[model samples]
Target: MNEPLAQRLRPKTLADVCGQQHLLAEGQVFRRTIESGRIPNMIFYGPSGTGKTTVARIIAENSGMTLHKLNGTSCGTGDIKAVLKDIGTLAGAGGILLYLDEIQYLNKKQQQSLLECIEDGSVTLIASTTENPYFYIYNALLSRCTVFEFKPLSAADVERGIRNALKKLSASEPQPVTMDEDACAYLAESAGGDLRKALGCLDFVVTAAPVDEGEKHVTLGMVQQVTRRTAMRYDRDGDDHYDIVSAYQKSMRGSDPNAALHYLARLLEAGDLPSACRRLMVCACEDVGLAYPQIIPIVKAAVDAANMVGLPEARLPLADAVILVATSPKSNSAHDAINAAIADVQAGRTGPIPRQLQNKHFDGEDAAVKGQNYKYAHDFENHWVEQQYLPDVLKDVKYYTFGDNRTEQAARAYWAKIKGEDKL
Candidate 1:
């Protein structure tokens, strides 16, 4: 390019873009929008440096659309209308696209103005936000726009980007430069799913040493020294997705708090929100149990907070919840009991419903099955009518041995009596 390597390498066409195959496919929403010359107001929500602006530029270039960009921080409510005045109506010849970045930062009023503009079709609103739109954006404006999310560039995407960057740089800067596979991989990890960051790192690596007149590869040592970022072997989306979370669950099950938190952190870093939430819920019921049942609310609150405030910011709540879940008194009586019952059922352990608890409240025939043998527990002394509930296959099966923690000891003692254990 006539500019710096970063600028020269900036993708100008949709074909040059990567990681948004979902949007770029033939006759897709994005391509259709470009072909039709009119796009509904939409938001491109995603993480930093994932080429949101680049793709926006590509769309604008292809559609013959001029744009007025408002990064939510810089413009206010009035600025929006005033710009609308300048960009008036575009019915016939061309359309004006209003590009807003970090739209989550837009206050209620600014968002409202944009909403009105979209309703009038004055301009196609193409907004981008790093934050989750549900929590940050005003629902009204969000409803008006066709929201599209931009996913973080994968390691492979970033690697491809680095190679492209080197090609562009060599076209102008000459003096062959290369990033070895290991170094490229490290650069992708260090970039944290950000394409611009990966390009920035690659730019630094090759430029670190004097340009030899021949092809020279950037080494892992040079990358480590220059970027100070570690490469993760496991795929954020695939390789370790299930395995890491499973280990995390087992760690919590085994009463290892530190290991549990480590896994929680990994989930947050990997953008695995639902997995993180599910794990916290498990930890709450299993590890934290009734002991300091207060931990349950904390875990619930964190789960809500994670959904309310996602990644980068949401990481805090997840971290806090995992720690509390990890450190709280551990118990899995409930989980073990349920799981044991599942195993019994799966093993073809069917038994007639105990006449004492059979459902029989429907019709005359159903009623016959109900009171025929059922005994109300409330009528029994202390609401303690005990009877065998396990199927024949697990007639003698027991689960959930309580931990040594004080909160669990009393429960252990109580259940141990029912279990016929020698000690609590």
Candidate 2:
């Protein structure tokens, strides 16, 4: 009778499922597929506690097919061969639903073997992964499966799940557990859109309560005792690590200090200072380039200081760097300029280097060398000279569009004054 609360309250039918209305809602194609009892090879991808496994199980139950579960991290060629062997006998009657959890862990070789099963439909492949399928799963295998992305459950859905688990506990135990409204809300919100985590917390609180009879009432204090400060669910080496760092950089680029700091705190808490520092440096140059170019050195200095002094103290300079980048005038002209030039080269626009601009520093090289025609800008007024710096093929091409920021506007204006026009 001592079952984990999350398992005990797992949604039996799709209707019982709480979140994922985008896919599970009425008239959705996925919903229709599940109801028709004719499921195709599918890949469920999302964060933890997002009901990917639960939905796969629901499909298995509704499809009336024998469910063969495999952990992708551990299951090998032998396991797949055994399943394929079983499919010959068992799948002939009702077909088979193979639920592979953590499918990203399946190496390229294992995935190649699984591709055979998918192609022949020996078993209806239902793979669930926390990592992005497009990034981790093999392209051949991914193309064969319909991907459904599950989002983190909303606060309301998590609250509902908490209430349902409490009801189940009350129905089963003589001394029903009662949770205060504030305590329930706190637990649900602190779960951070993770229903299974909420249920587990509730179970732990109810089980460990120091009560021998009657109803044990849970309060906010008790909830905090079990949930602590609700650590920011981050994995230092996993997809979450990259995801949070990406968010941090985007937040800085988008000029949102609030989101930048939020992601920064998460990174620091997860001990991912190196990623945080790297992202800030890139953001400073890529997003704030030329507009407020001084910020680049500032960010680099902050990063250097952070690396020299780790942790609690490191967070200070990081916070300062993030705030500075988020508040600075944003521009991507430099970043775009490089990319545009690279794209031209990639598209066969790579013209040879202008003879004048070619190196002439060799021992025997002299004014008669290929780059002898090079004009010295310092020889002219204002240290400015208009000459063909680019290759002949790209002479008319323009890159490095000036941003709206005053610093770049000044550069544009100065260029116009010297060159008689503003186009580069």
Candidate 3:
């Protein structure tokens, strides 16, 4: 009778679990994996509030295996060995399903320690990570587990989950939480494909006990009142933290604002601090660059705001920065140019620096050695410079392909006009 709302609302069967259409569809490999009954060692990778734990539970309970659960944060090698000793001799009747929640929290040695046990069939792992396993989990241990990537639960699933939770709550208490269609969508939107967050929200809504069960229906306003979250557990200092940022950057580069925002929001909501916001400043300038100069200043402002006022208050500025960067025009000419220059260096494209830039301010002879061939931009009427910046081996090589857009076109045209005197 004292069951938590989340537990009461948890999916009782695989059918009850939401999202993962790729895995849940009929005849799918994941579906087959589930029906296989003898579950293999697996790694479940995804963000928090997603269904990683839920799916692992389904796997354990549904399998004919005996369940053994441990938090990786608290678990040590001794605990693992004890579990392994039991598992090494476990019979078919005593099949073991070991669920390691937040397995990424365990250090490298701890992860590697389980490698032998898993390989020897001493333990069947169901390790869960809110980050990419390849980065957090040891390659040895990861190789032993069948990696299954879990996606966020959809809004529809969140809605269905809410309705079912209301039904279950009604079973215990005479009254249940009520919500209208738009209210449901709003809750789901706030949840952002996280069933746990949705159910936790529903639980909060019910606890609030809106007395007016009459035509005064549950609306988005009520849902917003109930679910005011400002923190997430994902640590920003770690590698996984950068991984999400990278995903957000690439997503923006790939022109997917939805995905970029999703990743960006996850980082900020997870308590990703000012430093991450600072990194975004470079990303905006270097990646968006001249293509969307607006992003540069906005990102700088966001970083300054975060530094001046820290989080959870800092999240607003961070979110604003992400939205600005994500929505801005994107180009990778700077990135490409750097890579091309590096390629030239590797390919023996060695030459002295152009004369104009050769430490003109410095008095030494070789100081200008690096800037030997540089031309003066202020010499021409338009203050344009026409000279070879690259060494002889790389002189003919051109990097920095412009994006086919208004901003890039203007930039390329200016670059061409400035450097056109090299027709010789």
Candidate 4:
């Protein structure tokens, strides 16, 4: 079988690697460490196509260690044992360097098996995981290894990689393979920071592009045909899901309708309507609270409409809710009030309920002693009356601070007038 273009284009040295400048840039700690030739047990944590495997290979070649590759998905304790058995043999003379990919898939026992080899210096481990290492990696193993995070490449970085891939393709093929500038830009932007994905797309386009006068010409249309939908890094059960949802709600709370819509579109593109809907409703109440009280029901209605219609169409109602919440006057007084009350209750600051406010039905013996003196507001002027509703300990404590927004200020004014405290 032919070697995949992405595989063929893999960086042979640290100098050739694209992106990950944070880790691999000149004078960077990681780059210095790798150059020092004293490799440590490390974990590479990041999304796919960020060059974790490629970097490991480079490290293995430089470290003078016998490199052994195993995937967590298929390897078991037996496979680990097989690798460990070579510790004293000629194959392990230079010391073993184990590059375990998808390390998150390995169970506790499987990971635990590596602890001994790692401790004794028999194996220098370089594990790569697409998921969060702290969440999936074994605690003991995690403690022993230094973790290095790999961030997604920028569009410019991916574009650099695409240019390099084109150069390599032209040199390897009998007929020159050239991509139009627009097509190169389109492929890079569409890759969503995954070099492997960009190379894969280029590979497909080159193989499928028609040869004109002994040259394969790749155009914007060819790139578009290969990547109709842009790559989106979202796993419903993963960290990206939570991150995007957080950004989605925060954008609305921050009152940036454009940013809010951008995140909303990402969630909808990932087919995560439930997360988008739930966040919109919460933002309406939490961020747009008393200032725009009616937005609560308005967002709820939009959410209901979205759930009924379902995606594509669902995005419309959800978009309306997102925009409404984003543009609405904002307040967190109601949310803050409830949280403060809950905290006081949790801290046992709540005393006995006032005698008048206590349930009368269960006060058979105490009814006569306590007296049913609950004042009725209907009989008073302005249909309002002062009453102590909180427990004795918290009677003087105020939790609901009226927000500065017009609606809340108006309500504050109305209450002050009704109580004849406006002059105070």
lDDT of each: 0.73, 0.87, 0.74, 0.91
User: Which model is ahead, 2 or 3, in terms of TM-score?
Assistant: 2
Over all chains combined, what TM-score does candidate 4 have? 0.92
TM-score of every model?
0.60, 0.88, 0.71, 0.92
Candidate 2 local lDDT, residue 120 = 88
Task: Please state the error at residue 122 of candidate 1 in Å.
Answer: 1.2
lDDT of 1 by residue, 65-160 (tens): 666778887888777876677654553237677778778778887788776657887678888887778878899888887778787778888878
lDDT of 3 at 155: 74
Say which prediction, candidate 1 or candidate 2, comes out ahead on lDDT.
Answer: 2
Q: How far is candidate 4 from the true structure (C-alpha RMSD, Å)?
A: 2.3
What's the residue-level lDDT of 11 in candidate 1?
Answer: 87
| Candidate 4, superposed: residue stretches over 4 Å from native | 87-90, 361-368
Indicate the worst ten consecutive residues by lDDT in candidate 4: 361-370
* Tens-digit per-residue lDDT, 1-424, candidate 4: 9788889999999889989999999999999999998999999999888899999888987788888899999999899999999999999999999999999999999999999889989999999998999999999999999999999989898999999988989998988998899989989899988999999889998999899999999999999998877577788988788889999999999999999999999999988888999999999999999999999888899999999999789988888888899999999999999999999999999988888887763567646565658888899988878998998899899999999999999999999988888998
Model 2 per-residue lDDT tens digits across residues 57-143: 988777877778899879987998877777668454688778899999989998998787789887789999988899999999999
Worst 10 residues of 3 by lDDT: 365-374
Q: Please list the residue runs of candidate 3 whose C-alpha ends up more than 4 Å from where it truly belongs after superposition.
A: 87-93, 174-177, 180-182, 210-221, 228-284, 287-334, 346-424
Q: Encode model 3's per-residue lDDT on 1-424: one tens digit a residue.
A: 8666777667777777777878777799988878988678998888676678888898888777777888988989898777766664635346677899999899998888888767876567898988778878888888788998887677787778777876766666655446687877778777767778787777776776565753224677778786666223345656557777788777766667688777767776676665467557867877788787767777887789987897777777877777677677777777778888788779877787645556655446545244345556787778874566665556777787888767988877777776673352
Ranking by lDDT: 4, 2, 3, 1
The TM-score obtained by model 1 is 0.60
lDDT of 1 at 178: 63
